[model samples]
Target: MTGLTDLFELHHDGALAENYPRLPGLLAELTAEELVRAGHLLSRVDADEVLAAQPDQRAVTTVITGPGTLDGLVAPMTAETARHGLLLRPVLAGFDSYVFVLSGDDPEIARHQPDLVLCVLDPSMITRELAVPWEAEDAERVLAEKLDLLEQLVAGFTARSDATLVLNTFPLPHELSAALVDRRSRARLSIAWHEAEVRLLRLAGEHPSVVVIDLDSLVAEGIPLTEPRMSVYAGAYLSEELLVRYAREAGHVARQITGLTKKCLVLDLDQTLWDGILAEDGPDGIAVGGGGRGDAFQAFQRVVKQIGSRGVLLAAVSKNEAEDVRAAFRAHPGMPLSEDDFVRITANWDPKHQNLTELAEALNIGVDSFVFADDSPYECGLVRRGLPGTAVVGLTEEPAWHPRDLLRDNWFTVTELTGEDRTRGVKYKQEVARKTFLSTFSSIEDYLRELDVTVHLGVATAAQAGRVAQMSLRTNQFNLTTHRLQHQDVTRLLADEDSIVFTIASRDRFGDNGIVGAVFYRRDGELAWIDNFLLSCRVFSRGIEQACLAAVLDHAFATGVHEMRAIYRPSLKNAVVREFYPRYGFTTHDHDDERTVFRHDLALPVEIPKHVRFTGEIERPVR
Candidate 1:
């Protein structure tokens, strides 16, 4: 087998650029050490060259700052970035200068604007600073002081930079707390240490762009907390193995920040969700919850259910009779998930890729948002070839590893949970009811009127920053400009006196789709610029989008703004809305291959759709 380094070297010519898309799959097959070597090989090539080769791909800059020897992390992190299809321009902070770099004291590092920053901190950094004799009061005070100083540094950095900060809860070493033989004394130190970790976790809640990765949980996941030999020999606190795992997590965060998160999980029913084929073993005979492999399969189902409970749509695709599969789900008492949990279930002998296409169409989302899992290698390979954009999780023979493999890439990770996220399954179910109701009406207008659709539009409050940011990230089909913003970015817009962040929430006879649309606009003198407009794909083809825009135009006219200019950026998925501005009585002021600027005269009198009732307040009396 040829190593990744050899492959890179073999394709060192322009062939590397041609093979860029294939690199991720090849890198995925390598071990951690091999991946790191591949990263080094990739680093030798020019980033601009690789990025320019793929003109359509978006690139993000990242800065990695920490307190120890972090040179070993660059290669692995680069490999991870390559796997994510990002051109990483990484700037590593000097050893023991995490504070200096983040505090803006290091001018060289502070000047570069990055999209994401990962701050890696280990317990040893704080432990080394503790009192020599380990006085309880002294330890507590030092921990508090260090945490406060770190908080100040983070605040200073965020105030100056727009990058999303990634922090981690430090894992406490046993020696530091267990130094005292007495359990009572040990407990005190442990509590104090954990309290400090809690403070670190709170930063994510306080700063919208800041997210804390639970390193403690990662440690619990079997990565060694520390390697004394590495610390003593090379002044490296975190083990190389730990860095490999941490790189994977940080990669996920980078992908999320850049709007590359997978929205759905497609599963193979037989031997994947459960232990055996439903057609052969029957629901009663299929091993599911008693013990051993059955218990593992049940646990995996529970994991899938939990994932579905939080926004990620679940679907099952199997090569079996539809009736038998539905009957199996009905008869299996140990099944953690009912058919209702799934957004779609296709049980037939169709190719999984074709079924996935149908599922994507039914859900009105891109297949790139999907992650497919199956136990058979042949099936996984078929889907991989057929739907290259879809992520495939090939289940191993060991049932115990099923859940772990499914989540290895953090495909459905979100920075924060919202009210909408908690009720996504219920909302999808409501959508089914709405679709069923749609068939009963003769005309689209009559159907919309009968559904009693009402859109509630308002200037967004501070609390809706998360949902607005989520819409900015997840919405692509009906999105104009496809501008990705973080929660802090949305909050900043809300706080700006010259800006209006309008949120659109819809409710009908079925249910309320919470905050499904956001329109970001700013006033410049007498002219208003709509920076971006995003409407959830779930609410497309309805009059809600037009109604929301009509209300916005009315609000601008009421505020005495004569003209509104909106931007539309062309993207692969957002081309469906290419004429959205023109369709709404806006004429193109200027246009090129990249974007079109459309201008609408507010005096033209925009009218909301009669079928859709729009009720909202738009702040008036502008300059």
Candidate 2:
């Protein structure tokens, strides 16, 4: 069976096998069923021991249940406890832990309350009679009602303690045919069941105290059901070899989902590393192109390249001449990565901080996404002061351990790294091209006139949804009100009659800044309230924000809206835009310590900035 070994070999070398020789032997002896049972046993044993041993640091706790147990009350209750245990494991792993089954109706797991309660349920425990047919519309309704009861149980558990509650969805079984006996419509029923599970999971995720564990996706990959041994019990009956491998893989994935740190290191070239400058070294003369001491820099570059490939943005901020660097990228055969690998390159002799700021602007990414790597401590300190959000790492550390250290420091653990991440460097290069083209123009109008800047305003598409949600999370400076929104929240607002969320895309002489800006607003009679207005800092000073606002206000006025209301909510990082609303003709209507409200009468058409030219027809919500 193609198992964890194959997946591991694809990304990692034989390091895992070499490190843990006993693991293979242990795995080979146990059947898949036995391994699953053992895992549960180990979890329970570990939880009891860890909780009993360390009580002071136990901030969170969880309890989980294995599949196919149907003792009714006991099974559901145990499942709830297990769910909490699993969800809070990452949070409490460094601290204390707890797990216990309640014997009586005294549903609270223990006399002392936990800081958090995590409840998990196995779909197999719910009676076949209770299971709703996948085709029935009432299936969701029934599931919701059941979930409500489960939530209430969790509430009861956390009643004595100030613990938050979390409910996890049941993982769907792997075997399709066993669950769907109706042979003719098995595929349709399976699809429906999967959809139903997702809906239930989403509902759980939306709960105040719930973090839905997407275990269905976690376990469903690999281990095909075509094999008879694997087919039984939803293809969970794997050979002993597969079971042990699967556990380790699952554990790793779990760790990724819960791990902290999500930024990357960007390096600088030249005297930053070796004794001599690369521009003077002329490729072959450089210290990095050979054996001995050169190997360290080569190893560092290899590590940086690997990190970049794994979704971390690798950027270059150097003081050397740009042409010299370009030559090194093209001519140097020893180089691990080329010019195309870097997301942003600022090689001018300008202030390092200014270069970083320009890099941030060009990438449409926040300064927080950056971790500057330079050999000079002076430069690192300067950047730290200029861009406080950015993290800086020096090259003074051990040369041999630098690669591993860099990876450890700038680790970006994620369940899935999307396609956008892979092409990010290329995209930033295109942005650089755009900026260069803009530089050639004598005036802003000339640039806009020459480059056909088309602003396609549309309701948020699925592709654009992630970017919108990301903007809410990462954007600060230009965000009118820094209200972070989830993807579902954005979707709901877009669908609501009282609200409108629009994204702006620009394709000009350079390239496309795909959905670079998003604005969300709602109307109240004649007053149009601005909920959110944020533009990518990359497209700043391009008059794109002005154009977007103009289009929105024009649309609002034409639709019979007399006034537009906006709020300037101050944040520690957004001090640059303290007077943003006032500058845009908004009069101060109300003020408090926390927030300032401004209103503008939409009587006249606001002058569009000369640098921006709107096109391709805008469709706005009419009041």
Candidate 3:
């Protein structure tokens, strides 16, 4: 196979610039061997052009590879990462590109402090005796040894480093044995190997820091597993095509880790939900869920259902009449999703973008948390242009590929599921009820009074840490400071003697809205500095923010804190709370480009809201 040396022989530095522009057309025509060679050469320009334009603004990610000739794999991974960086430039905020650090097998994982650690262990790395495994007795022994080694490595990495680990499960060889085994004789080696794979896949569930990428399934799904010479020269096992997809998936993991993941999927009806236009064909004429042409729609709906189970809120923003859409969902026999599944539904004939805006408002989530999917290019384009924050997915004409296309973007991936996730669908369903109840009240205070709301301001227990961390990541609009934290980080804050971490949960006549606020404060002598102050938008405009601040201040004062300091670092999405601290009686002492500092004298009495009843220690802020 043509190697990197061959690429060097084919093109000198002078030819690189000329060939770069024609790179796309050239890739399709290249053989597997030549593609590998091209990847090596592409590595030479590691953001050379991208960095020349953006300069010193790349998102830094470190890649710790497993045992093998993996050094050769670095260039291809970097090239793929650079391409994705360009695709995700808008999502990355200030970063225009990504620069990666490729470390050897098992360097000090904690010392590196990488944003992500890609665990690229191959089957050979686990057990070298696969080829020599015609012997029956060594099979279980081999599997056990491999499992122990794998678990030890993962456990150690997680214990030492907080970096999100993306572990690739060991893939069984396409042809596992020399011949088919007679199961009556002994345990089949193939069966043993398959069991080992299952055990490897289950590691993600046991650990909070791991996201196992199933390369085995990727290959089975027909991403061609070709490795010509790179495995020999560079320890790389995947083909160029497979490697490209792997890197894309890796980038998705990285995006989710950084809180860049979208929260909601706003879908369209008509051809999108069924085979025919609902308005033109009428409800009965439109094809859905009775096999034949509607099979594709059913398949797509099933995928949407699966995603919702994993905690992505589903909603419909269609142009059809509300009654027609309701009837269509009710009439379809095999419809995978019901109206109940959707957290919000805007079925009227208003502008799709306006419906999306209303959905965001009703859900109390930012517009950027949305992913709008529609079969029509016109409707998708409207939302994309009108609501710049929402992710607009372009659909192909073929309905069969719709679900696959949606999955390709990797909008929702989290390292761990929180308490909030398990009940997210229920909470969002309840939110619709809460939004309806809001319109009945004359004023915000009256609404709060009528709901019989109660606020608990106490140090969050270990069990509630995950939900607190989630609010820190998802609460952008009402967040005083946009500091993204994970559950482990919140745990660390709790252990610090000088830091106070508080959790807020509110329940009314509607339902138990799980822990929705997190505040982290650091004690400095007689002063308490607020590091993060956030409340879920679900409880917004209800004087809950006032109640929260008053609780925090009262606690500080009781602890002998002379003054309270807070920093409000504004972001593009957090402008809604730009003046949040000032509204709650915090006096601005310093202002700068990065953050605005506010100070409150703890000696001064705080006013508690009349609506919310308190449940924990400390007096309700004095009126």
Candidate 4:
């Protein structure tokens, strides 16, 4: 009655479904027993009702299977999905049937065709059946067999389905070490166990569709690796606390795979970035990097820069004068970030929320893609209320812990990092220069001609699969069919003889935008149909889409294809491109409530944009 139950009682009609949104925030205040009780309470609520209450809900088909009783995880996992505005349509696998389910032995699970699959293995899976007095060689043999089974399962699942496979590195049980107490025996056992965990972590790197959760890291955070009593009686190897944390990590991966990841990190320049206020502490008086508390602020800045290097845009909103902030950056030698590191720096008297809106506009991204961090609670509250979609990180008074707090939710987690991600900040900085030059000319054509844009449009190489898959996921606005694909899927398409996977990249007088557009189509004798076509929103309104589509049509015609058909599936964000195909003389072939198909005859050639220049399929930077 003191924790979630009390909050439940306070709700109208004592309905726990109404409290679903607040459950994640109240987790820290709950005791272990209360957390278990809360999970049970959440499990009783109708999932359909909770999803109905959410304004923006994404339903992911999930399947949970392991070598033990995992029923308890389904509830906490459901609650975690609710926290992120996601609904889980889970297919329950048989208990202790990890191999059977993963090996394609279970027909229901195999046919379920889930979007996210969570498979957790515990130490007992290997230890319980180990031979007595097993030496290092014997341990290695068993580990090899288990690894083979896992690899086979992973390969089979990935080959058959596009769902992401989530695995975990299990902690070594104490029984293994206790049974082998001698120094030599203990050393061998420990080495073998460590090698096994390392091998498990390598699966994530080997398969683009696979993600591994490190249970050892969770245990390092003071959560007990396993509940002995539960393991002995209920066959639940993972403790409830560990399961809750594991569910959170799984939720992060789900968000990333579903294209709900944050794109930018907006910071406050006062006490949040530095140790003190610039107005009161003076330019040289502030603590930045000399020693003591200043080093903490410096460390925080270093972490922010590292994050920026990974393609997350950095921005700042400060109420101080613009010159004062600029002077502070110049005066501080220990500052890891310069004015150029940020895409936008707003230093004015406007409300922080208004500045954030303007920052999103300037960057050509949505407010929801931002993660705003401020040391002041008032400012955080204002942004939270003003833009409910933006993730707000309220930093405490301690600057040393700011980095940990900011990344607690893993807002920018990605499955794979590409060259474009590493250099995104620099490209945005170049965009600022492009905008400034655009204002100098009244005619758009003159501005484009002066900019000197060069585009690369051709069959995508195997090496460009990651960038194409990334574009498929993140390019929503200009996406023709809105198909979300993974790297493995793109790789598969690249190998098909009948399918054409092509990419488009643009570089102007400013900078290279990387692989900004892609098209997936299949050829059938003399006919072709587009599977999906998308262009990055950053290149919109620059005639890149027109140029790219023209090239695609011309290529199809030259290939002896008589007609090319394209589908336009309307999404909430892609209304701007609804009439895209029709502008190029494509006639409507079929129309429905959900989608429209347009067909183009290969009788005439499509004209490329005159202002833009086409280049060979090569990736090179002007700088």
Candidate 5:
């Protein structure tokens, strides 16, 4: 049985290898025999034993190629030895767990159920065989065969009532046999095979119950197989240190895929469980400070904070004065969180539904990803009723039990947390700052001047692609034609001669609002049509919109384009920007219930505010 020490070692090795390539070389240089020993050590470590010690309830079934399959060996072993006393039920009832080897092609295995079926394909049949190169005709034949097999598998899974199928794609070839060791030729073949595997994984994910785990990425990272020292499985004649690090990664992934957890938690403060308002209690009297009830709440806050650090976004939705909460956060010496911790906060008198809506908007996350936690049953019920998609946890019986109960709900496990997840809260706070700055200025020009705004007008880059796609999806109020695009679509637009996509980023004394706006345009000879135009609401009232319009039009006029046309397609949330085009000197040429099209002559220079400085040089495409 592996302990926490083994798990920590595995995680450290995986992180170091993936993030720092130099670490692998350094470890390899230490000793050739030491690298092999490390690989052997990692392979022997049982990840399920470490998981059992944790307070997790989910069944984690590991499949190994043997006579007794996961059901016969792993399940009973987990149930008997697990530290958390969790029910580790076998997915397969009959025979030793090793029966899964024969059941891979068995129809009964799909019907006669388990919570998780660990299917281990025969290595000899799947991996040991050389991949046949697909000529044009062979490619067609292979696709047809795989598609037919996939359809049958999908149907078999759909017929099952209780089981959720998780399919592991075939692992990468490990043999470095003399026949296969032509390095240069093997690299090209490997790339082709990898692409084929990706397509297979995508096909598997098309089924609801099936989650296709990319076994190749796992193998690339490292996985241990039992074979002779000179054999491909021994972690010799390859990057043994790198492979060991990757095997640990594979183990971590195996645990995560089977773990039961939620994505995010929504919190509320005040009388729910706390003794008094944070603002009034001055942090010390607030139940989260130190001892007694305060100790429990403090423990809860610490737990919640830890969850946030692990990719679960923490949002606050309370019916208190915003200023009071802000003051409490600033001055309360015992306060666990500052204003920066929460991704979104509704510390106003707004209804819980409204707060939740704002919270979802601010985070740019789906409502389903949110799990609302409040000590008051009424508030929880209100949220549950108003936002059906959101998972609202009620603190009905014991208010102090809320934190543990929330944790029991398993609402904070996610497979990956990108860079966007860590900085989301800070981004929202910057948005708040931008909004506050906009409110202080009486006129658009004044707002622009106070901002000391610098508008970057350079051509779009690959880095801005994600932000551009996100703005298109999330922006509602100012979006003219709500044409939601993926990152790839944005990339394509930037490359096309007929279309243009430009980004707008602003920075003032307050802070940097990174890439808050985007505009997409289509050129038709003498006229340029605005396909989509939207800005982050954070930069609203800042005259940045006007600056963007002025800049684009200036480019068009210089390029000998005579006319520019824009359309306003009304949406439920875009009432604020209905007359946006007209205000910018565009004459209303057409209107309908659905859309209002406006046109302006590019020959006439639109009035430009003096404060907004366009710094970057424009790269005009050659005719």
Candidate 6:
């Protein structure tokens, strides 16, 4: 089989459309030589050439600058962005198109206000004391000063704009100490580097906009010192290999910040999870623990478990007998996974792709949200070719590489976690029960009333800010504008006196559905505009949407606003809600190929659904 790197050489000129989305996966397979070659080739391609070749590009503006010589970085980074953009184009309505202004020449980073401000720095630029820390008289004091400078740089940018700032952390050199004991201890080299990394990370946590790339974490042994010839001749302080690696990693970070994160991880149970095929080698006979290849499988399972804990839904799609697989989840003493960890488990006689489609519906997430990992190339190929939206990982036959292969890609990347993230898996599992309960009811209206749905519509509270932001990020199916916002944006809206944000939380007899829907609108002069309107697909097929819309209309009427405007920007995933406004008596005020502008006259009466209950005793029922 031809390697992924070989495939890129044939299609790097943007000649193929079907191959664009697969470039990021192929880029990961490049050898050091291939990576450098690809980087150089990309650097030569101009933005106009890139645009002419691929008109499907999403215009993403960015300014990349740092404290050192980033001139050589411009071309390679641009190439990486173009390729990464092509990969993300299909999934992200459009991939980011980046244009750069040199580091010192143009410092309009905060002025222009681009989508991303990527700051890259070298470890060699650290405190002079760090270079010879073993003999420095005041190493600790010098280190503290350097850290303060780093903090100021990050804090200053965050204060200027809410745009994402991805700053690379300092990498520690292994040669800092000859003794392993001293290197691991509170000695000068270890303390200086480790404390600097910790402080930068803490600053990142304080602001939602700051994202530290963690070069320190990506390379544990630290990056190799620049060769004397390359440093002098080419003005390069880092190896070409490391530079190519960092470029790819940074590209992944950009995707996450822009809300291009995957939601679900589907796995095959046989050789993928454990060492042996389950039915052939019974639960006890399966190679699961000790010093065998089973140990490698254990390591891979731990990584998947860690991701699940963070919020990614885990599912099993295998051809084993249903009861046998359930028995393994229960009986396998060495299994790190439980039945609770998986939201959907399909172990049946049907084709794997058929099971995956049902899983996507049950989860209420797009097929694009899934990343399937299986040991069989045939199975992985089946899903990749049949369902192009789902990202597929063909796990290596060698067990040791499983974890490394999966984690290296960062498929489920997110800029930051919300309060709802930790409970995401639990909520989906509860959804399984919700599906079963709905089956017990006959009529649609009766089922909704039995749900006893309560939507609290008003200004959102501090606790609901994360969920409000999450609704914007995750609700593409029912979202009108597709404006993905972070919690800080929601917080700003809540603090603004003119803008009002509404949150809808539902609890059926089932359980607390949490905050599943939200809206942001403002009254300007005599007209009120809907800035964002989104509802989670989990709450679809109920009267929740109609009730939410009615409440928004009533709220606008109470504000003494005469007219209302709603906008819809077309995207592949949001097609379901295209005709929503016109159905509710909204007139088409303006029309375009990409967006439709709808206006509603507030003089007309609003029909609030009777099924949805309201809390906080603030209901101005218009019906």
By lDDT, the best candidate is: 1
lDDT of each: 0.83, 0.56, 0.70, 0.82, 0.56, 0.70
The per-residue C-alpha lDDT of model 1 at residue 540 equals: 87
Position 42, candidate 5: lDDT: 35
Which model is ahead, 1 or 5, in terms of lDDT? 1
320, model 1: CA deviation in Å?
1.3
> What's the TM-score of each model vs. the native?
0.92, 0.55, 0.80, 0.92, 0.50, 0.87
- Tens digits of per-residue lDDT, candidate 4, 1-623, equal 45465656735375555555555444433554565566566656666776666533467789899988888787777656655656667777877888887777888887878889899888877876678867766777787788888998998888877889999999877766777768887788778888888988999998999999999988888888889899999999888888988987888888777787888999998888888888888888788889988999999999999999899999999999899999988878889999988988899999999998987777777888889999999998798778877888889999989988888789998888999999998888788778888899999989988888888887898889988888887777888877789889999999999998988889998878888888888999998998788887777788777777777777777677799999999876788999999988889999997799999996765566888887654332211
Write the residue-wise lDDT of candidate 6 on 438-478 in tens digits. Answer: 79988777777787777766668877777787677667789
In candidate 6, which residue ranges exceed 4 Å CA deviation?
A: 1-36, 39-59, 71-112, 127-142, 174-186, 221-225, 437-442, 616-618, 621-623
Q: At residue 89, give the lDDT of candidate 2.
A: 41
Determine which window of 10 residues in candidate 6 has minimal summed lDDT. Answer: 89-98
- Taking the tens digit of each residue's C-alpha lDDT, what string does model 1 give over 1-623? 25475566656654676567676566755777787788887766667777667665666677888877888778888888888766678888887888887887788876777888888988767777876777666677878998999899899988878899888888888777777778887777778889999999999888878888888888897888778988878878898888888888888888898888888899998888888877887777888899989999999999999999888889989999999888888888888988989977899989989999988877777888889999999998888778877888999989899988998899999878889988886776677677778889889988887888889888899888888998898787888998899888888888899999999999989888888898888998889998998998888888988888887887888777889999999886788999888988999999887889999987565567888887888632232
Tell how far residue 256 is off in model 5, in angstroms.
21
| Model 5, span 14-108: residue lDDT tens | 54222221222223112323433443333333445534443223344433332111222232233221222123333343433333333355555
Error of 6 at 576 (Å): 1.2
What is the TM-score of candidate 6? 0.87
Cα-based RMSD of the predictions, in order? 2.9, 14.6, 7.2, 4.1, 18.5, 4.8
Quote the positional error of residue 322 for candidate 5 in Å: 9.6
* Model 4 lDDT, residue 500, Cα: 85
* Model 1 TM-score (2 dp): 0.92
Give residue 66's lDDT in candidate 1 (0 to 100).
84
Q: Which candidate achieves the best TM-score against the true structure?
A: 1
The TM-score-based order of candidates, best leading, equals 1, 4, 6, 3, 2, 5
